[model samples]
Target: MDVIVNAAASADGKLSSRRREQLAISGADDFARVDRLRAASDAVVVGVGTVLADDPHLTVKDDDLRSQRREDDRPGNPARVVVDSSGRTPTDAAILDDEATTYVCLSEAAPVDRRMALADHAELITAGEGRVDLLRAFATLQEEGLEQLMVEGGGELIFSLFEAGLVDELRLFVGPKIIGGRDAPTLADGEGFVSEFPTLELAAVDRLDDGVVLTWRVDDR
Candidate 1:
């Protein structure tokens, strides 16, 4: 399974802008690109924090795009995969309520009762925390037939993957508005957070009217 990072941030690197209440801050092109990325993947993933902050449907809603998502080659909306590291994902989340398939990647430490409850419909995988093992989770998903995985991260989960060298590609759309707060979250920790990320080679750079979109592959090798 290949992990792809798909996200949007403020020009100043804040994930949700300093306001943290409005999502309209994300430019049109960035939102479009995110949906396009979802159309191309087998699974769309988000961390628990994102679930709470943004109750996204994670489905392509555009009329034409809906058909495109249901084609033979790249058909059907991708399964919604949530990273609920501690089984803390709200049981009533829209992601779980929707008719589409849903999955929860949680830690082994999750209570047996909680695991049983979540397993009612959503598949639950015990990917431990701190040193949470993403490799095992990826292997499990691959065996289950998921190939391309797009991760729409919050913070911690993104940092973990980059630090673990599990992220293969990154696509970012940065809006121009400067929501300047001393403490705003960035795109997990791609290159300069927890530690210096393995240098990534730029793949594409396009400037949108009020934002910049960047694409990169981890090294040419």
Candidate 2:
């Protein structure tokens, strides 16, 4: 099982300059590739901010992909997981619906009542405090028969995972347009660029229809 991150950002490196929630600049082909990636993964994970801001269904909606996701259980769609340190995901969010098997990972400081409420709708895992412990999250998912986790994230999630050496592969789609926002978030933040992880190295690069794709691997060394 691997944790793969897929995302598109502006040439100037802002994923969303329009709003924190809106990815208004990605091209249609990027969307298709994203769908394909989702179709292939065993589970999809994201930070709570993405869940709260986007409220995405996280489903592969092409008719064939949809059918493939629903049949045979194991071969079907990936379960949905969210990293929610505060346990603040909305009760009405699509992840809470039973149609998608959902899991929420919370930090130790998250309140018991909130965990209980989430348990009413989804499986709850308590990781360490301040951030989600992705290693433990993966172990929990493995127990549920999920492999090949894809993380579609807000900035913090991506940075933390990269820092923790939990990421196996990273897929970045660089959109053609440049957004010169002063406060835009990078996939990794601040001195994060200065501090190298134990074994991260470039794997491959390709140009997509409207963006460039960069694939990286966190080597075991």
Candidate 3:
């Protein structure tokens, strides 16, 4: 399966400040590009924190693009995948609005009630004991015939995927704004590398109307 991670960060490499917020880093052009990417993908993924913080719809929103996808015999919208290890995703989250198929990946220890509630709006899949086992989740996605997955992030999810060697490509849009804070979230945030380091080879760079988008391929070999 091909896994692509996508994000738009500030000039200072911050996704957002350490405040209650929904960061508007991407511009209209970037959003249209993202919609095209979403239309091309089999599934669009994000962490539960993204849902709790931004309440994004996580579906293809452009009418013409949606029409074009359907004309091409594709799904009107890609399936929505949410990684919620502890099952913290709200039942009313925008991703659960039935705009598309929703998969809630949870830990094995997720509470039964929470699982049941989410099941009303999503298909629940247990991937790990106390956190999401991304490899298992990928296997499940592949089994479901959703091989082209796009992971949009809220830091933790991106870090986990990168750490697990699941990310194949990364599309980072660098905006002009700089939200500098020691506590601000970044593109990849977790217990970062200490000894051995991973690298991403630059594949392409394009200047958008409001920012520059850089594409990199993870070179784990």
RMSD to truth, every model: 2.5, 2.2, 1.0
State in Å the error of residue 83, model 2.
0.3
**Can you tell me which runs of candidate 3 are displaced by over 4 Å?**
none
How many collisions per candidate? 1, 1, 0
lDDT string for model 1 (125-213, tens) is: 77766434777877777887889999988767788778777789998888866776765667774345544647888999988758788
Question: Clash number for model 3?
Answer: 0
Error of 2 at 99 (Å): 2.5
Question: Over the stretch 43-134, how does candidate 3's per-residue lDDT look in tens digits?
Answer: 99999989999988988989998899889987899999999998889888889997889999999989999998998999988988989899
Candidate 2: regions farther than 4 A off: 70-75, 190-193, 197-200
By TM-score, who's the top model here? 3
**TM-scores of all predicted structures:** 0.89, 0.89, 0.97
Q: What is the C-alpha lDDT of each candidate?
A: 0.76, 0.80, 0.91
How large an RMSD does model 3 have? 1.0
